[model samples]
Target chain A: MGRRVKVLLIGFGSVGRALAKVIALKRKIINSRYGILIDVVGVADSKGMALKAEGFDEYELLKLCEVPRSGVNLFKPYAHQGVDLNILYSNTQPDVHVELTPSEYTSGEPGLSNIMYAIDRGAHVVTANKAPLVLKYKEIVSRALSRGVRIKFRATVLGGTPFISTLTSMRSHDVERIEGILNATSNFILTEMHEKLVEFTDALKMAQALGIAEADPTLDIDGVDAAAKIVIISNILERPLKIEEINRESISRVSLRDIIDAVRQGYVIKSIASFDVRGGKASIRIAKIPRSELFAQINGVMNGVRIRSDATEVVFIGRGGGGIETAHSVLDDIVSLSFEDS
Target chain B: MLGRRLCVVKIGGSLLRDSKSYIESAQKIREVFVENGYKAIIVVSAAKGVTDKLVQVAKGSQEALRHIVEKYLEVAKELNSVKVIKRVNEELKRLEIVAGAINRSGVDLSLYDFLLSFGERISKILLVGALEATGVNALELHADELIVTNETFSDASIDYISTSANLEKLYSSIVDSPTIPVIEGFIGSTIDGRITTLGRGGSDYTATAIASLLNIDRVYLVTDVDGIMTADPDIVENAKLVRTMSYRESLEASLHGAKRINPKAFEPLEKFYSSKLIIGSWSKFGTEIVKEIPRELWGPKVIMNRASQDMSYMAIVGEGTSSVQFIRNVLEIIDRNGIEILGLQSYVHRPSLLVYVSSTYELKTLHLLHKELFEGV
Candidate 1:
């Protein structure tokens, strides 16, 4: 409550909305309970940036989102709409920057561009966009560390659930194996198909109907999204996993008959993003787990992670992808960054 | 309650309503317990109101049947525990057939009991699954298996000998196995394998019965309220919490309609059991009702009152209540104020007395008694 920490957010998308929701809901929780207040001082989209040096009002931001073609160009008073990133960063020195832009694999430019700018300004970075971490983990981490600022992307792996922190904490122990249902869209489709004995297309339709799967859902169904998360994990664990190195298998190959067969066999097929760090080399793949496997039981849009560590084998289950859930994660990073507890 | 070294936490339906809260509470519980070197075995109820709604379906409310099924399915979808949802749906289908037979053949109480037990059974299974899912090595023990009861229809009496034997057989290794064993409260069974419920607010009884039978340390009945207040909070605006009370006081207060402790919950911990029972909320700082008085306490025999729409009762419970002078002193104070007491009862077995009066005189009576008890000139 003493000092209000400023936050710079890039890419005002679904995840951006979620993070903002957490700040609004947890504003009282943070102030009364944790004695910290975080302000999203700056927010930018693909078009331009908005700057409010004092604080970017959450209500205004949410209203701006509701308006058509008006992400960074909402209000005129305190909010300087349509200002570019260079002008926004230099003018309003933020404490933390949140990168949540659209993910691009070959070139993580949009996310990397904001990340570099934020780090150069001695501001911390919290992002959910996977392209930045998957493409340039070492460079970003080193830059943030050299500047004595933190870089957290809990949303990138398992939105707002602390999977990355949990993994990093268990680094003291020998983590022999790691497995999870990281992609919620694939899991939702598979669970629907298996439970109803419906065809893959019907299940995908159901997922789309329920807003669980995206319209295209190619990255999720094709295992690209989960593979990207595995790569992030590999980089965090110091295993250095490349996107090309993973033996990726898409859930689309699973036919209606395959789903029925698995159900009859007392097994549920989940898109498992896994890594075995014990061996000299690590591998990432989407493999079928028996009914007894913990990952098999995780269904719908829920995401679960099981880390077979030296001390214990623990499971972390949560809403894998939701505007609200992931937003809470981004808010969590901001809170930890501002509060003394984390 | 494990021992002097443990804390028995009963997580009721209010807390375990969703996966996020479950995981959050689990993490917080583990953090606090692990830090203090205390082991905890949490007894979880069904996610808020799922049990009652399930019962409506079983009792042949056709209109409520589909709604009940959808609720469980929704929770299963939310918790990602569809195995439970599938099993519950199958059981519900079977229940529909049984209910039809029951409707034709006159309502069988035993069948009704079996039908009601499904809620707790499903809840226990899902909660344990969820706890395990959240990385808390938790196992589910059926209340029927752990809590043997008589063949009473709605309210069943616990058969301790058989129940203890069953619990020992099923969960002896779990004491130190570092795995939390979750059991359904309020539902148990007879020797003949007939399902029976422990009755209203029976989950607390189930938790205490297990704690006493297992001889674990403390039984924490975590409810929605902070603790037993000096008066019913809704009626008395200035009701403050009585931080520490004896089991005798809690029993008296509960008898007088204080919702903190279940009256039946105290029967199991009556004897030489050292396990203390603490009544607190999910947040913290409630009342601690112990089996015996610890030496360090310094407090008067607090007057705890509860007032409903028509009735009000004040309970004065303490070891000092045995003396005739104390009783007279309390009576004379109420009498001097010209307050008409409807009922006054004292027990020789316990150190407590209850005074039930009309709700109209509650405020005036409390003012006179407060001056007499604490602010004596």
Candidate 2:
């Protein structure tokens, strides 16, 4: 009722649905706390899009959350044919564009093009989709800057907390090194293997059963997910790194034997991602560290990061990869952007 | 008439068996509530014996898990909706994965609770499918998403404050609309989102809790039986149907081993008393129960034979049943009938009395008590 921020949403997967649920659940609180009302002007899924020029209400958003997986086109009365991002933007102009398409590291397709279209329209872009940001953070940021529009992707990396924003605020110090357990699926498997004395295959199966790991966990186990976060972190630190620039070692390399051996020596095998700012090198490896270290204590689906600079070192830790957690991150970005003077 | 009169109807597990049964139940709801200008929140239990099968699977029963997957898939196929079938298959696939993990690892209580919950969760889907197939618009509200509870794994209690807030917020938006929301019963989630079950026979508890919290006036605990009987029908051939009962009498009757009721259900009704519970079959809905019994109806409503240690006892349950006058009358009856008893125990605070007797005379005492108290002999 105070100030309304119109948004166009791209993607309707788990994260997207969770975002809708949270928005519907928090509508009154958000309006009261921030004096801002967020109205999703349009939503695009793989099948098609749904649009309303005045933006959707809580009831519509809640219904959208229940739409079958990739079945937004089935939503009646308001369901529009085709998922062309350009059509969505042109139909009803939005103040902010939120992109949540699944990460497409190689091409960042759809998301890359969708985000570029939003920026071209002079709209502030808030993206939880890591593909576009990982590929062309500088280009995206520069384009948004030139257009005098803000781009917030806090959900792209360590989104469980304000990791990127904190890093930005510490620019006054001479940055030295960064290390973290960035991938929740890999971390969960490692934790299960260590605590339960299970083999690699068993641990991964358990992770899959528990939904910590996806059906095809190649991206997570092969360290590609960690590498993506590292690339995003590197870019945030103004290092201008690319996704392919970071070397990745699969966490699968660690076996039950390795874990036992590590435990015998008061150490644990953890999938750790590191960036040496001074040397300009970054990689995610299966590293062995002493049992009492902060990274060793980071277990299950919880992610943790350690950053060191000339003045001090600090640790940040929280849940990282759940849809609801990432949805909150996306919501926070949307709300923060809504408060800024246009 | 006045803004759609509201009621809560809980379809018990006994009323759900095959796809046909689910359809029949949905039709009954449509005829009784939907078509009657009423807005009802339908709470449903797992299909008959599904929870037992899941309990076995949770205890490492290999055969039961396969039975569950086949049974649910078959029922979903019978529903004939591709969308419903797909969703049910996905849920069963997830269930299989969780079961596999539980089998690999030793059984953990938390996981066991989550495993047992598949019964209600899957049934909710099938029921929703059934409702839609019957030309009734229904929505599936997974109990995990709404029924917030304490941290107990198998016997969790609903945290009314949190659950009330959730129900008010979620249901208010749709209560005025024509579509109905069907929620799974006997299951809730911890505040942290871990699945917890409300013990067995807890579906009635779930229904009453919603009615009490939402301030609805009536709850139908739809089961296979025709309301509460004066005695166990299997034991006593002349058992009569109890037309009415006080909330306390039902609670006491259930506590003393009376058939067809769960003592756990009285918590919400006792605390709030905002709703009345009617227990019966879908065809014949009768047996009204409210917070207080009328003075004329404040007498023994049921008699049950129960065993404690090596002693068997006959329990008489009703309001004002623990008074000295009633005890004197019961003693006079035992004397008149030449029925020997070991002891009689009653608490003035509770509306029940336990009359202990030898096991040989247990049935005799129950029959005599039913004849004298319930049959008005």
Per-model TM-score versus the true fold: 0.48, 0.91
Task: Note the residue pairs that clash in candidate 1.
Answer: A18-A327, A19-A327, A160-A329, B1-B8, B1-B217
Model 2 TM-score, 2 decimals:
0.91
Q: Candidate 1, what DockQ?
A: 0.01
TM-score of chain A of each: 0.92, 0.97
Deviation (Å) of B309 in candidate 1? 13
- Give the alpha-carbon lDDT of every model: 0.70, 0.85
- Candidate 2 residue lDDT tens string, A1-342: 669888888999888988887787786678888898888889988888999888787767876766667777766668887887777878888999999988888888889988888989988899988888888888898999998899998887887888877888897988899998998899989998999898888888788876778889999999988998888888888886777788899988888999999999999999999999888899998899999998999998889998999999989998888877888899998998988853
lDDT string for model 2 (B142-214, tens) is 6887889999889999998899889877775565556778998899998766789998788888999988888
**Candidate 1: misplaced stretches above 4 Å?**
A1-342, B1-7, B16-21, B34-37, B81-102, B294-313, B335-344, B347-350, B356-359, B367-377
**Candidate 1 root-mean-square deviation in Å:** 17.8
In the range A14-110, model 1's lDDT, one tens digit per residue, is 6776565456435645766776777777777766666778775544443334322333554344445564777877777888888888788889877
